[model samples]
Target: MTDAESPANGSGVGAVRSHLESTISGTLESRNAGAFVHAGSRHDPTVRYCRVALGRRWPRERGREVVAVAFDGDEWLTASSDDASGHPAETLAVRLAERSGSNTILTPAAVPHDAALYLERAGLDLASTDVVARARATKTTAERDRIADAQAAASAGIRRAASLLADAAIDDGRLAADGDPITPNRLRTTIDEAIVSAGAFPAGTTVVNPDPEHAPSTLDGEGTANDGDTSEVPLRPGEPIVLETAPRGPDGYHAGLVRTLVVDSDGGRERRAHVGATQSFRSAAAMLTADAESVTSVEADLEAEVRAFGFGEGDDVRTRAFGVGLEPCERPFEGGDRIDPGSVVRLESAVHVDDGSWLRIADLLVSSEDGERAAYLEAPSRSLEPSALLE
Candidate 1:
């Protein structure tokens, strides 16, 4: 690091701020203003927000990632891993224009906007921002690799959650194993401990009742139960248990796992539903093995399987499967997102019974080059029974 770039000590935030302030230099003011515009947080200081954003995107190598800073009263684009010093802003502008062609390009609208300068340097004109965003959405193999690892950790967490509930029964405000009730707050603490033992972060955990009348509600991913529903209620025989967990690595890659269990009962009706749902999950898994299949295609197949299993169309199965990455869920499998060769997704297929009987199982799915051999991190059995563990 140069004298101008030396980081401050004491706290991580301080060091980050120092580095950003120095690295950005004259561009800091403009970048800070842009940060506010993007964040839409009037109370948040622009400089602090810029520092945080940069910290999140900090590349391992100083010059490997692309970054734009206001420089010489203009926005300058540079890649620490590649073009560290960067060309004149006008040159980069031209390049951006050429890459976009008919698409529109966007630049920072805040303090030190110089997108026009970079565009001119690249011998191109500024276009629409949408086009540039589209191009950047595509993932690389390296990123997919990280995402796959994250999913593996997340799957491990789900297994741990299953173990925690193996003998758990909730009574009143407390959860019980045999007859003794455990407090509602203890549930998270216990589950979280188990998750750590299983080798994954306790990103989030929720064990809630599935409501038919209000079943159409969406999961915020934070695991909150809808309305006044009480997940803290006593666990009764024949009631369903939903456990969703996600774990992230230090690298920011993440994965998710969702498992639904019914207390100690695997009767014909319950077993049938579980079997059918598990089969549906497997079918989707099978389809994901192929690289040629897109996320939408996989979702369609999963839905079809659910329907074929005798479930009515009115029963909303909720989300099919989605991409898992840095944000717990990322690209490729997000709704409306396409699956590319380098994408990593999580496969979830579920069946809900009228009496709040639900069965959901999730696994990390990696797209394969063959379009027929997608990989999975969670190898739990498709049966949903204890005997089906790791099959």
Candidate 2:
């Protein structure tokens, strides 16, 4: 590398290291998110550490004594709130502003639905930018390590999820671990249990698409499948099963992976189709790394590949594979999207049919070399047939 490039890269790495240390130390006040604390533990000290980290990253435009507010907090009492009016809780921004003698406050884009109007009413100057969003999108070396572990955890979850389905398909209603009739509800129940065991939190979405009849967005959804039927659909001999697993690691990095499998019979046609689509996704991702193309370009490339693979053309294809770190789905994948070097992506090419089961084969990757190369969490299987379930 050139001397200039070396220093610049070094500085970026130093910045990430400094930020994480200070945040973990809890020397500063934070505004962007709930302070970093241990998982499932009640400790307010984490807040102080996060404040220091986030506060330091606060742009000078926010001015000294900058206050940052994370929309998702314990004090948030409502599932949804009017952002135009300040919520009832004592906001971090307000309190920090008063303490630091700063008049301006910044908020994450995920701020309440009416955040713009609400901040205006609070008598504080407010501005919105994806500064934090972009920063969080790219994964640092340390951050990527955490994400790698998280992705491994996700891979484990996917295997367990698929195993449960396979057991149900072959074992005449008998569960895999519990040895009971594997019902739809039971499949979800077992999956949740496995997620917890894997040391990750469960998202509301489903990574598995075993049947066309059951198209619930998330595996944990209690709502009936697309058909609105309660009848249980266990894994069958020739049915395609999509194993999609996304779980937040111990350090909060999201790792997402999807694999398509057929219980007893390898669906050759579906497997070949999935392989072709996955290759296209790999190509698009390669360009994303090489050219540092915006999310839009990546999305377009993926869509084009899907159409080439003989999937329906146009926007009808379900395609979005972008950054998923800190909070999953952190960036939108569309053409002309400016690139960030540290962003991690879960680029996916989903294959859905009209009233038939669809599948997704995806991998969580980190962008590097100024967006020229995408580093996978690990070597991902290019096809549905895993020599051994990926871990």
Deviation (Å) of 205 in candidate 1: 6.2
Q: Looking at candidate 2, what is the lDDT of residue 41?
A: 12
lDDT of 2 by residue, 1-391 (tens): 1101011122334566464544322321354332211211111222222332333222213121212234222221111112214342234434433443334444434444443454455565554434444445555676677677767766666666566554443465323335554444555555556766776665544445544454532243344446453324444445555666677654445677777765555455566567657767678757766756677777678777777766655424666667676556666454455556666787777766435567667787677764357667773455554334533
Cα lDDT listed for each candidate: 0.48, 0.52
The C-alpha stretches of model 2 lying farther than 4 A from their native spots are 1-14, 17-124, 163-190, 205-207, 210-231, 266-268, 310-316, 332-335, 370-372, 379-382
Top candidate when judged by lDDT against the true structure: 2
Residue-pair clashes per candidate: 36, 26
Residue-wise C-alpha lDDT for candidate 1, range 208-266, written one tens digit per residue: 33333322222322344334434343445455555566665444455566666655664
Clashes of 2: 26
TM-score of each: 0.60, 0.66
Among all windows of 10 consecutive residues in model 2, the one with the lowest summed lDDT is 1-10
